[model samples]
Target: MAVPGCAGTPPQGPAPRGPRRVPVSLWAVPPVAALALAFLYPLALVVQQSFTPDEGGTSLAPYTEVFASESFRSALTTTVWLALGSTTGCLVLGFVLALVIAFVPFPGARAVARFIDVFLSFPSFLITLALLFVYGTVGMANGVWTGVTGASDGPFHFLTTPWGVLLAEITYFTPFVMRPLLAAFSQLDTAQLEVASSLGARPARIVRRVILPEALPALAAGGSLVLVMCLNEFGIVLFTGAKGVTTLPMLVYSKAILESDYPAACVVAVVNIVISVGLYGLYRVVSRRAGA
Candidate 1:
């Protein structure tokens, strides 16, 4: 063996060191700080304002007054029913559409499925606008009706109603439900469908037996997300121009902007946050259970 420092051989320096890795905890600091500043800080301010009334002392007077108000109660009722109704519509419509797209082989079926991924990027206002173009007072449907029947005003006045808000919400949010379902459907075993078909199972039976069980987790995940979103949805309601359809978000806007009642606005905002956060936690628990 050569000596430690041979004449012909150049002695090796210390092995080259790669860059030192920062600890994961250290890596997390920037994002944690950013989140605290962007989200937590504002949320804390809002929560603080909710308790500290405009009269200057911290008290529950605002909450008590808001809770007792007829407008608050009406807004609360409208918000809950609309969110629930829209979520139900999205689930049923999304489930059926996902099944057809995933299972039923058809021309451009893949293209339609791909379009759904793009559709998710669309804003809620765009959907509401599109619905308005089709169904607004002087929109295409009414125009066609008026032109055909020589009527002064068409019967399509629902666009300014709560149902219009519901329709717009469903149209916009259904894609959210569909995206998760299509992903879940992709992972499903086609062999089960084939075997079920071979066993003389009817289409409904196969869907009910083989497919529904597997899709439950995705359904729960999508439904929970949709519920939270619908609860916070402001654009669709606002764009629908349904003055009578006062949601919690609208109430918050009305209180803060129109009435200049910042305390009441903060209280409503706090209540909305509590509901959304509670539902989001439920979503997290369900997602963990489903491994979704």
Candidate 2:
């Protein structure tokens, strides 16, 4: 045994500590559990319901029935077309608006951009209803035109057509595109643009070369978001009263609420969710690549 106070006793470095273990995985458990409770369980239920028809254990009968139905096919086709058209329209119009607000030196460009942001707070159905006020047969356009021109009809009857649904979706979703695009434009190296301008690159060519390439990632994100939303948009198409604009979401609503076909509705809902999730994944991949 060593003496307590003798200088001959070797100074002991801290008694060897047991290897420190970082419980890094403990941090992940809460989020993983939350994700399972929030997403996985609900999705499993939806998938199970989609497979069940007539209270049976499991079958693909619901999917088969939905695929065989003419209305289902028509609704899916219409939804795809409308989603594509609306996303493209939003990309074009939103890019132009964002460019003007970002690069163009206007007095109130920032103010206008902020004003456009207010649209995001408004419910989508409101935009459709507002369009009705402007373009409905007995609404403002018709009322004013008929009164002024002494004509029996109004100039705008497109409200009940596919054009109306497309327009409403674009109008509602363009700000989404604009918000991301303005962020993208804000980060762009204006020095590159200035150099292109000095080299006599025309506006359109400069946009095609320098601007569009840089903007593509933001465009992908915005377009994916808009496309997914438009794919599931019910209020805009329904409120517009567009006969040709029934989307998959509208089909799900009608099948469940009007026709009481819960299994078919679940099948359609599952498809819509799959598409939205897949597009969201693509957006993530594009974002990562752009960052790299």
Candidate 3:
């Protein structure tokens, strides 16, 4: 019953698919390959160096030396205290500043915020230098106090002390904490606050029950970042730390530069990396819980 041309041919199956052609670009391969060579290779080298002996033997002698040394123990303790103090100070100041900026309208608020942003862009070293000029024995405060009291002694002897280092860290890292907290505060629902107010809830009650809960994640994240930064700090310490007030970074520097002990330096570096990683992990867990 079929037509003549149709009757001559049998039913055909679907056509077979051709192999997919992957684009091979020179651009794509070079970047990934170059990254492996540059970053990964260097990190691997350091890890190898940490484990291997400087004299061509395998050992954990450097780690033992680091653990047994009284100086290292003292330095580690000092570093922890410095980091904790700095982080705490930054959190308190940054939280208050962020709250004011977010909730309180004032003349030149925008300008003030812009000024803070610009200040953050300035070098930490420059700030340290300014602090030296303002706080050192021959500095402004010293001169003023001496003139007023007719005393030979300075008003504040925080220069080249742990307190000075902590102050510098808080000043530098407060911006980190403030920026995130400000964003968190800005994103809050004003309607909820108004509802609470209308219901005769005290301002303190509303902040405690609503605002803080909402902002906790951001606050924790910012605080954790500042803490980690303080832990790894070196520049401010170098400029401000006293003779016996050696932090972990300063100790590592001493070992590497002063004593020419690369292995011992590596041990301290590894310890720093471990502590940083652990604290960051803890931050992640807390942040996730707060968000949930």
Candidate 4:
């Protein structure tokens, strides 16, 4: 006795119950277990080794000895300054490039953006070598200058200095900053920019107010990444042969491989791991907040 709408509709069968979902937390166990085995276990082993003594019990003697050495102190200072300088340089240059690629209209703008991606795939050491050819005293600029002026040395001695390491670090890491920044820029609301422009807001003002606000997250994330990477950078500093620029990574290598001071090397390595982990945590927080 079904009515036109529903009054007398036949009784339907019971609704089919879908299979119960396993809690997502349960599903996450395997990956979490794998990560613990892969990462945390290794980290724990390093920490344990750092504490282990030659006589075979826990001791802080390694850390005490390593930190007491002036060479360790000098290497640490070099690591910190290099990380900061290179990160700052990368952020500034990368942000500007990202702005140009994202907002400024010009020929081959898209092509330039695509080229930035290529840099990430390239090995950082190659950039160091290329800089050598361009600025290493006997390289092109110097070669031309020497041929023209009969100079004994080229003006481009920075390549052999810490500043050269800085330059190489900046060049290699800028693309890291640019990649995140471009992604953030792409998600920005163009309408706001259009409105600002229509309202006669100057380009710099528009950038300062409308753009920079949205970019801070990417900046934080990228800068932290570059800082962490720079702290561990061995190839550029080593290849540049920069005098007195031994970073923690280089020191760790020298201690473990050359000097065979495993405990001391472990001390330095553990410190680096702590710093990198702290910065990475900061990066994760900022990136999540920014939805980047």
Candidate 5:
């Protein structure tokens, strides 16, 4: 017999079993399998093609050829420079824009921010084309500059030049950098900012000590995204940068289309994928550290 208030002992010979196993639904399996096949299979094919030998069996000849070519070397260098320049420019401009939108008191600031969002939604190639209308040799800004200075030509040459491509990229991607940073800034604790201010921290000091650290993760993530976008950019470069600039993407296009060298194109594409993946990994590590 059990004591008072004690629960009665169970009379079962076996313990109660857990819930029955539920099989994954057929609907879910199809979508998952479709995604794997559609994206992963093509990517695997590209990687395999990159390794296929020009002469016969699997070899590193494609990669070796890419690295050995002077054109490839120049293209790689130009790609790196363009990516770095556009990324840095976007970061600087976007950070400043985000700060103004988030903290500063100004008329129509909300409207301006909304407009930026709208602008970001527009296609990047369209922005590049619009820039041609404003800064190209026959564009309005150049025309005005030429008229004002009585110069033989426009002060700026944005058509088919590296600078043109860089400028176009920065304009297009600045919003990419801005949106994440603005979100981060908006999420910051106002109480902490007030506390810092009450402790006699100057505006600059408070920003440096309190704000930048909190925003670093967003900045890093956005910058990495911009870098990746810039790395794979082909449309704008093809239009406004055909003169002297030769990026990896452009090389891949040229090889595939003009030379009909599918293997070489695959090789260039594989290199791009590796570089982008490596950079994204680095960004993730850095962002995690910053958050910590």
Candidate 6:
């Protein structure tokens, strides 16, 4: 004696299970394995080579010799100072230019802002080359000076000096700072600027109080990126023909290619990688905190 509805329904089995699905994390394995093989493996080789000596045993002798060398010390010092100087210059110059492009309403301002993106794609060596044309020994500046003053040699011989490298780095990397700044600035409230202006705040005061606070994160990120890039820069130094400017990367090139000192090259490369990775890690932490 089954009830009309309750007993009419037979027992229902469990809902149909779909085909076994892979865990989401498992999908990441292929890419991670590929990365390990492609990048991590080579980096490990370099690290291993850095520890290896010409005598063919794993030891720190190569590092000892390389670090003790005068060239390594000079290159390390030059690399640090140049990277710091270029980063400072880029931050200052980029901030000012970005401010003008973002706030000062002028004709072609948008065009100029857009041009920064294109500027970033231009190779670093191109900027060095361009600077050479304008400031090289017989370039425009020297040519004009020579033609006007009738001097045998122009006064612009600094093109192959450290200062020239600094200038080229600033010129090439400034746009990197500016691009992030512009993005940050775009999100800034126009109303605040207007209110500040109406409340009798001077331009400089408004910038200092209002604009700068909002821009600090972007500035920090941009500056960090420029710092790392400057640290690793080889093309600009090489193209500038700044024989005097032997940075870490340039030292690596000379050691590996010219001297055939693979162990020494690896040692310099490891140092550079450590610095770059440490800075990058710091940047990530700072950025995360800033965002929070």
Per-model CA lDDT versus the true structure: 0.93, 0.90, 0.84, 0.91, 0.88, 0.95
For candidate 1, the TM-score is 0.92
- Report the lDDT tens digits of candidate 5 across residue range 65-99: 87898988899999999999999999999998898
Best by lDDT: 6
The positional error of residue 243 in candidate 1, measured at the CA in angstroms, is 2.7
lDDT of 4: 0.91
lDDT of 6 by residue, 78-116 (tens): 999999999999999999999999999999999999899
- Give lDDT tens digits, candidate 1, residues 1-292: 5677878777889999999998889988999999999999999998889888888989999999999999999999999999999999999999999999999999999999999999999999999999999999989999999999999999998979999999999999998999999999999998999999999999999999999999998899789889999999999999999978999999999999999999899999999999999989878886888677
How do all models score by TM-score? 0.92, 0.87, 0.85, 0.85, 0.85, 0.93
Error in Å for residue 36 of model 2 = 3.2
How would you encode candidate 4's per-residue C-alpha lDDT over 1-292 as one tens digit per residue?
5565587677778899999989978988999999999999988888888887677889998888888999999999999999999999999999998998898899999888899888899887899999999998789999998889998877888988899999999999999999999999999999999999999999999999999999998888789889999998999998898887899999999999999888888899999988898888877886788687
Stretches off by above 4 angstroms in model 1 are: 1-21, 287-292
Clashing pairs in 2: none
lDDT, residue 241, model 4: 84
Residue pairs clashing in model 1 are none
The candidate 3 region of ten consecutive residues with least summed lDDT is 1-10
Q: Identify the leading candidate in terms of TM-score.
A: 6
lDDT of 1 at 174: 92
Q: Which one wins by lDDT: 1 or 3?
A: 1
- CA lDDT, candidate 5, residue 184: 96
lDDT (Cα, 0-100) at 141 in candidate 5: 90
User: Comparing 1 and 4 by lDDT, which wins?
Assistant: 1
Give a tens-digit lDDT track for model 3, residues 85-110.
98999888998888788778899877
CA-only RMSD, every prediction: 3.0, 3.4, 4.0, 5.5, 5.3, 2.5
